[model samples]
Target: MITKQSVIGFIGTGVMGKSMARNLQKEGFPLHVYTRTKEKAAELIEHGAVWKNSVQELAASSDVIITMVGYPQDVEEVYFGEAGILENAKEHTYVIDMTTSKPSLAVDIYRKAKEKNIFALDAPVSGGDIGAKNGTLAIMVGGDEDVFQRMMPIFEVLGENIRLQGGAGSGQHTKLANQITIASNMIGVCEAIVYAKKAGLNPEKVLESISTGAAGSFSLSKLGPRMLKGDFAPGFYVKHFIKDMTIALESAKEMGLSTPGLELSLRLYKELAEKGEADSGTQALIKLFE
Candidate 1:
């Protein structure tokens, strides 16, 4: 049972982070939030979250600091910058990063946190904006089992499924595996939607049939209708998805693994982003085919 005394410091109020923080707050944890823009902090504040001005301020005050920032650079700034969390983090703090960043960066941050006797985890998450909003995200966490278990109740408020996959950087690795599947799945859903539209079948009916079968995917069931409607509002931004795919491909290259399909998917997403689709939802990949 997490109390109001547990100051939930969430350092990234972007689409998914905001929803995750809002859900945590709704479940009764007092929140301390920081984002680059004050305007971006607006929604969280209205939902019973207290806004903090800087990452260090959030770190110094909070019992548990959770970061959901974007990219490797964003993670660095939040945890290791001049006024970063690491520089100011107090003892008995459990620092959890929910960012989908490079595994190497996660390892670097974890070592630094350990030197300070702070318990930190690389706990990246999946299930997109909808999942974050609904508190049903599938979380992949990597930390000491004791720290992971201690944080379990808090994670329960933010995600439907949580697993402590392994140590150090395992969460990010699991997230890469997750992105590999999501990339392939998005392509399948995109092609299916395009094919159904041209074949004179109501894509919705086709969606119903495929969804209950083994052919089903989250993309097909949740985002297919929106793709058919041509609405590109973000459920998961194409930019973020492309970043995850690129990270997975880089990891594959380092380990000498073959993933031609992921390479192809990465290229397609880059083309979509270059054509100005970065901010749109991943479902907008269907527009690339159209």
Candidate 2:
């Protein structure tokens, strides 16, 4: 029963979270925000989001809490720490985690939340920075179906294509599958550009020829131009991409599935990370070829 009157608490105001939180504000929900760095949330604060000094305070006051933090460890800390969400959220409050994290952790949070009569959802999203700013992300959710339905209005505000994949942790599993595709796709995008360059064809012209054809993909169409212009800035960070691939690799191993392509992509990303490109975007994989 999320309404315009529901007090929304948002934690994590980084590259994507800031825009996502802004959209919620635009929809007229009163937003309470908490981030590790208060300055990171200055714009939202200026736009009428009240900044809470602690997670416990935000959880206690908010009707619906959304988190888009970094790393599985960070997720664990925010939800399970001494002053964490589960410890402080009011009964019947809805807690949604939008971070790309392990499915097991999502299930764990769901179980813990249910014991306290709270509604918990793992609703990881795709589409990176551009998607966040444009409100065109694809949100994959896992939780009780009724709870998913309850959060549709909020989801609609933040994403274009939203789906309830299944029960607890399903959203994270689906996100892992999405990351698997992107892992291979990013490599292909990098190789295509590198191949075009080596063959003395103008890579931009080559992109024009193939981008609309079967070879076209999100990475090629969106991140390819950035590659051509040597804009290795992060639409999504290499460290985060590596974290995702590592999770996918571990998840695949658990399911007794083979993921050779994902493995190779992980290796390449690890190489780039080792070379101190960890803060760069995934498209910076082209640096490997250079």
Give each model's whole-structure lDDT.
0.88, 0.95
> What digit string (tens of lDDT, one per residue) describes model 2 on residues 1-290?
77899999999998899999999999999999999999999999999999999999999999999999999999999999679999999999999999999999999999999999999999999999999998899999999999999999999999999999999999999999999999999899998898999999999999998999999888999899998899989888999999998998999999999999999999999999999999998889999987
lDDT of predicted model 2: 0.95
Candidate 1 clashing pairs, residues 3+ apart or interchain = none
Which ten residues in a row are the worst by lDDT in model 2? 281-290
lDDT of 1 by residue, 1-290 (tens): 34667888889889899888888888788889888987887988877778888888889999899998878888998899679999887887889999998888888988999999988899999888889999999999987899898898898988878999999899999999999988888888988888998998998899989998998778888898888788899988889888899999999999999998898899999999999999999988887898
lDDT of 1 at 49: 79
Clashes of each: 0, 0
